[model samples]
Target: MTTGQIAIIVLILLGAGFMLISAIGIVRLPDVFSRMHAAGKASTVGISCLLLGAGFFFLDEFLFYRMIVLIALIFATAPISTTALARAVYNNEPALRRQLRHDEMAGSVAEAISAPPADGDDAILTTPS
Candidate 1:
């Protein structure tokens, strides 16, 4: 009914919508990369809108600044962190269990682990030294 009430409603709607859409994306997406995209987009926007709007509703300058800073922190870290996690999973996924063909790094660890023992000159000697 009031302007403040309207703003609060709008903020809630925006945050809820983003979260719901993200949930759908996570459930409906076909693979790891796409799911990560969906989660990152929804959560970042949802947190920014929700925290920023709560700051406005609270009418405190410190709260507002804190909310904005928190949003900035999320944006600064969430995507890159999530992307790296996804990349790690993609790169190190189990060979026999993974269905993906784009994993060039998938077998790197396995190859290293399975490689034959190096000869005397090539092997490291840690005795006493």
Candidate 2:
């Protein structure tokens, strides 16, 4: 086999390995946050590597552009999606919330939970006299 083919195979194997580890992490982790963390990081990199390998193997203009767009989309959205998922888990799952060592959004949560509703009739507006 050519060097390029070998490199492609290696990259694909490495990507598969990362994906396997990510799957294991999702299964083994104690909480949603940790599982998301593992899956988000590992899967993003894994998919990227796999795409890179495919792109290298194919080496066409259309394929290259598609791969670039896919990679960019993954890079842009993965972290945002992970954060959103974690926040949803945090909001919805009390049991998992307790497993967290530090509650970064605790104050915001408390404030939101404690804040009273603002009724139109209760609004106090003062104009500069």
Candidate 3:
């Protein structure tokens, strides 16, 4: 096989390996936050690598650009979405709060949870009005 083919295979295998580890982490983790962390970080990298391999294999300018865009989107959105989901889950689920050891967001999240909803707003994390 050509060097390029070998490189493509390596990227695919690396991506698949990361995905496999992420799947295992999601299944084995004890909490929703941990599982989300695993799914978010590892899957983003795995999908990016897989897309890169596919882009190389196709060698079409249009498709390659699309693949790059997809990778960028995944990298850009995964962490933000993960953080939002974590915050939402933490605010909604009291049991999850007890599992935290450090509680870095304690002050902010606690304030948000306890603060009374503003006029026409019922969300837990409310903005100052």
- How many pairs collide in each candidate, listed in order? 0, 0, 0
Best of the candidates, lDDT: 3
Residue range 83-114, candidate 1, lDDT tens digits:
77775554344432256555454445444344
What stretches of model 2 exceed 4 Å from their correct place?
A: 112-129
Worst 10 residues of 1 by lDDT: 120-129
Q: Say which candidate scores most in TM-score.
A: 3
Clashing pairs in 2: none
Return the number of clashes found in candidate 2: 0
lDDT string, candidate 3, 1-129, tens digits: 999999999999999999999999999999998999899989888998899999999999999999999998888888888888987887776667767786666557646665655673455343222
Deviation in angstroms for 28 in model 2?
1.0
- Model 1 reaches what TM-score against the true structure? 0.69
TM-scores, all models, native as reference = 0.69, 0.79, 0.83
Which is better, 2 or 3, measured by lDDT?
Answer: 3
**Residue 34 in model 3: lDDT:** 92
Candidate 2 whole-model C-alpha lDDT, 0 to 1: 0.78
How many Å off is the CA of 114 in candidate 3?
A: 9.5
